[model samples]
Target chain A: MMPMKLEDLLRTKPVFVNVGVRSFGDSLREAGYQVIHVDWSPPAGGDQKMAELLDDLL
Target chain B: MTLKEKINAANEEALRRIVAANPVLVDVAPASEVVPGMRDKLILHSGPPVTWERMCGAQRGAAIGMCLFEGWAKDAASAERMLAQGEIAFEPNHHHATVGPMAGTITKNMWVWVVQNKAFGNRAQCRQVESFQQFGDYSKEALSGLQKWRDIWAPTLRAAVRKMDGVMLKPLIARALQMGDEMHNRVVASSSIFANAIAPILVDCGRSKEDVVATLYYIGNHPFLFLGLAMAAGKAAMDPARGIEASTVVTAMARNGTEFGIQVSGLDGEWFTAPSPRVKGLFLPGWKDADAGADMGDSAITETVGWGGAVIGGAPGILTFTGGTAEEALGFSREMRNISVGRSPDYLIPALNFEGAAVGIDIRKVMQTNTVPVIDTAIAHKEPGHSIIGGGIVRPPLECFKKALTRFGEKYKE
Candidate 1:
């Protein structure tokens, strides 16, 4: 990961990639903030074994 | 000092006590043995105090199940009759230094996790998690699971917990926040950590191999097992904030399916209530929004002290279960900061560059911003004798916050 300057990050209009709760994004958009929704679901459709394996490896 | 200054100072002190409180998992014992005021035929429930007449379906089911579990009634009809006849005394879990999950019905014989807040010398308790009855399932299987806990699981885990001299929960929670656990809807990390902590103790307790394996397997399989302990810890953390005059920080937020309620630090035990709102989110196959019960549980205690939905940004894995993207999770955390009074000094969200989780929900800020506290919760079936139907996010009814604000004005405004 490359380090980004805090000042540079702040200079741009804030755009949000909304992952959950559409109302949250709606609230932000109503407040004039830009938002992009990500239709998020669990990796492997929430398989317990896979999740545990990933936890162990990661 | 002006009232405003005093309120601010008191809120800061309340937040300090909340962040400073260290909750340790001290023991596992029957509710009657550990929870003060717990007695035979007495039942503790979630949210504000509600009578049998007003108890929601799932709550009523759990209460009837408790009656059967306690042997006070032989069947559902008899149990309902006993409850209606006032043979069973009901009280809110908050009044008894305890908290429970959905339905949150606890009777005297149930085994409860005992957590102690070392800083304030206050203790809180919660019933152990089980798949069936607690969610209002009154089937034979659910009753059997409870019986199994009473006969086998409880004693095995109790002996193990005793041998380990009690498990310290705060350190595990601190680590879990970094590992994608918000300690509410998703507690995978905390659950795993707890299992890891007690695995060796169970092994060394001289229990039968079958019992040890069964106990460990049970703990490992249930990812939300830590939620009960987390609720107890949250209760301990927030209990000290109660009765701090003029503080507007919310100390408790709970739902009983019928109504949602909150208690402010300044007002102590007084609850401001509104009709419990319907949940909006994903549901299981064959189940839809209409089948879902209203939001329920005392698990929102996690949000009361920080973490849970207030820090969702740190727990992206929860997005999969609750339906959200990582960015929205992060956004949720930042948005909560707008309505909260301070950041937790201990519970930090790694996804937000290790920023402290927002803490101390302030009624003034909530009303001013037109934003209420959000909670990620599991939805139960609308009727009893059914398992959880889905999971979703919900907000405290705006009316509850507005009512609190009105009360604050009446009490503090000159």
Candidate 2:
């Protein structure tokens, strides 16, 4: 369970890096914590076929 | 080299051409005389090649208006019949080294701003923006405005351009970005800069006081006066990037009210198209979203070369017309950077702490990030005989970029 490490992190303030969905970061900001939000979404608008095609080219 | 490495090399080369381009406003002249291959019976419309039967309502009305302008028909009914019967040849402005906004109808006798990319020695042209007929009003009043351009405005401006030996457009465009002009939907700063440079030349033109007064007054007050010239500059700058093997930079983006299309650098002489999408925009009084037409215009050329929506961070004032918050505008600029090859060396934006404008749309990054380019533009009424109703922001259909990527895979054997 990593009790030692989990207890140590709980003992201090935490800075967060949030990706995609912004609500998570906003919630943290509301709670008076530090958060960095990354504006992102699924590639090719989440079309599986298009995503595969893009991967092939890459 | 491997395919990935080869593609990177080609894209870098294409980006070099895009950033190195020096587009100069060389002249104002008739399309028949300046645009390559323009002919007496031909009318160039916006977007990709479309048949008369498939033409949208606004475009159809503009076609009839142009026919009347060319003296091919005496009335709208007869003009519509001629276009329907295919008696008059129709082609896209992009096919003729030209571009125009909205309905984008350019007849042989129409005057156009000519821009030459001094770096590559290739030129492009675009007709001046009309207040009404461009969006399909063909009333006697609308047609009279065309007569004014034909009879009065064009000749006076042409003389000034010749006397000045051509205006250097790049410096003005660079400065406009700092003054909050995206160079597409809003060009007030560029308009003023153009007027400031040409006012004295028009003064020494030795014309009648009445003539110079009318010309200067119109130029000074018209806010979008520089958009067509900037569009020609975009075309002139981007054309040289086309035909670079393995390059995935988008060379052109246009719409014809019915469909939206794009061209890639490696895929020369080809277009990827999808049905046109509606623009979410703020409308004029008594107008609603239902009254607006589908996205249309050759003005997306500005975004291709990274001037319009790509640099919106520097021009938050456009948000009022295009409908977005200043925060969103700044976000768009940052997002565009992810899709482009790099920032431009010439056009810099203050909002980003003086970073260069985003330059060179790479289709690969578009596929990678699933982000399409944004365009700030004016909106027209959907009906055949109405004029502009509003202004807004629009994006090309994702299908266009997806199809381009699929074709890229096949062409490069990736």
lDDT of each: 0.86, 0.89
User: How big is the positional error of residue B47 in model 2, measured in Å on the Cα after superposition?
Assistant: 0.6
Residue B5 error for model 2, in Å?
1.3
Error of 1 at B275 (Å): 0.4
Residue clash pairs of candidate 1: A19-B324, A19-B325, A19-B328, A20-B324, A20-B325
Clashes of each: 5, 0
Q: Which stretches of candidate 2 lie over 4 Å from their true place?
A: A1-17, A22-36
Once fitted onto the true fold, the runs of candidate 1 whose alpha carbons sit more than 4 angstroms away are A1-58
- Predicted complexes: DockQ each: 0.02, 0.62
lDDT of 1 by residue, B56-78 (tens): 88888888889989899999999
Highest lDDT among the candidates is held by which one? 2
Q: Write out the backbone clash pairs for model 2.
A: none
User: Could you give the CAPRI-style class of model 1?
Assistant: incorrect
